[model samples]
Target: MEPLDWNKHYDLANLPKFDMTLCWNCKAPATKVCSGCKETRYCTSECQKAHWKKHKAHCKMFGQMHMMGELPKIMKKNEPKYKGPSMGRCSGCNVRFTPNYPPNDKCPECGYTACESCVVHEVRGTCHCTNHNFGRTYCIMEPRWYHKNGKTGEPYIGDRHPEDPLHEYTPDMYEPVERQCNNCKKITKVFKKEYWNPQRFNTSWF
Candidate 1:
């Protein structure tokens, strides 16, 4: 997604006060609310620029609302809701299923149903998750092995072992698995001891 041009929507007098008191940019006391969205705040221009990448989508939506002169109405409509399960295909695997499927959970923002496997994969960083707000999906990085003698202090280029053709490597040999978030598409390094949660974590996603 592209960054929003906030300069086009800078009208402080027309902007509303954000419900939160803290700045979304620096978590400091905010003195200004984003004139474009009126939903985000920043302590200064530098902070706003730093947070623009994460806030652009919401900012653009609000800008659209301002253009239509329906900011209030649209904000109310976009409010989060507890949407019980509805019949639909899994957002992750695109498999069709009923609401009663044991592995389904509906998105509160978009009413999209994600199957258990897909949700597991998302949280575990094995695959991508659908973003209802953006009408698109984000993906996690794939796992890779590093070479022993290749360039040091630089990106790793995979090295082949003599047994590559005769033996299979298992992930169990590694300590802490590296996974990525589907929402932010950022890598998360997790240790088995600290991140393991039987209720929410599933190895099947790997």
Candidate 2:
């Protein structure tokens, strides 16, 4: 048996227990080697300048991590929340902003936040024995299809067996709406229901 490299196993750890190769100013990988005297490192143009004071004495020592001829493989946060526009300095006063979400990021928590459309597009999965993409869904609160009937033998419906519910709407939801975008162009849409009820009954009893 051998001691394992924690960095390799815990590279994505969120808590501050481990030190990541982050630019002193911003919490990003210091992958870009400094060109000035070729003895410093930073993640962006701004960090390069911000870290100069600290990195000046280390010119003869290790400067920064060279990009291994590869753009770091970043896992995209699906439907990442759009926290408006952000502009700020890093812990070392280096300014930068990412297009995704704000800077106070952790792995698992950040992975779940999403924007409106991506939040509503809906998702599904397949059974191991027979792969299928059943759209009609159910949840204890909303997903209407796959809910547990609470009857003798109904399985919990449209739940996470496939994936968490996305678009939430039961069958009887046919309706339309009109709106205008920032350009003032008219738009209309009908958020149709997921499943069509086959247990039809007469509507004339009113």
Candidate 3:
């Protein structure tokens, strides 16, 4: 999708010049444009093939886009909204739950309904044991949320198990704990907060 403020760009939009003297696949300018995409000009088919290794993924799906002048879909941001409940029903063939009992199916009956495409999970609790797994893990508390926005860059209260992908946020997962340095032969770890404030290692002023 277009960036947030795309309407403002309509007047300023500039189509790239498909300069047909260089390689179109690489945008290096092409001696001949491919009759297929017409957007690329390759010095030789060999140049196109060499570039294909990196370009194939985008090439197949992008072929029609290049010719038809349409942009690809943009990815949604990662973090989920922390709303209270399902306001509507599930689009994924969900049935309504009776008021007496909680909806105990793949889909839920209450809280704000999301576009099925947008919904990651129907249940609200963090820690993956959504449906009362015997372990019944604790809800990853917000304070512990990724070590309070620690440098690890894991989301707050991500899934707890180190094996779980979100485990990266758990302070204990990566531990930032001491490790034997392969180079120095001394124990090493991430610099402590005393020495590593974001302003020093992060924001800068020239």
Q: Find the 10 residues in a row with the least total lDDT in model 2.
A: 124-133
Select the stronger candidate by lDDT from 1 and 2.
Answer: 1
The TM-score obtained by model 2 is: 0.19
Residues 88-160, candidate 2: write the lDDT tens digits: 4221122343466343421121122223232232321111111111222232222333232211224442212
Sort by TM-score, top down from the best:
1, 3, 2
In the range 117-194, model 3's lDDT, one tens digit per residue, is 333332322222232111222222112221321112333232222123432342532336676533233454433333
lDDT of 1 by residue, 1-206 (tens): 23445667657566555547777866898888788776677888888889887887778777665656775787889987634334566655667776567545554444555677765453321222122211322211122221111112222221111123534434543245555543444455422332222233333533
Instruction: Please say which candidate is ahead in lDDT: 2 or 3.
Output: 3
Rate residue 196 of model 1 by lDDT: 24
Runs of candidate 3 exceeding 4 Å displacement: 1-20, 24-29, 69-206
State TM-scores per candidate.
Answer: 0.23, 0.19, 0.22
Tell me which residue pairs clash in candidate 2: 25-92, 79-114, 137-145, 138-143, 138-146, 138-158, 146-157, 146-158, 147-157, 148-156
Candidate 2, superposed: residue stretches over 4 Å from native: 1-21, 36-40, 63-206
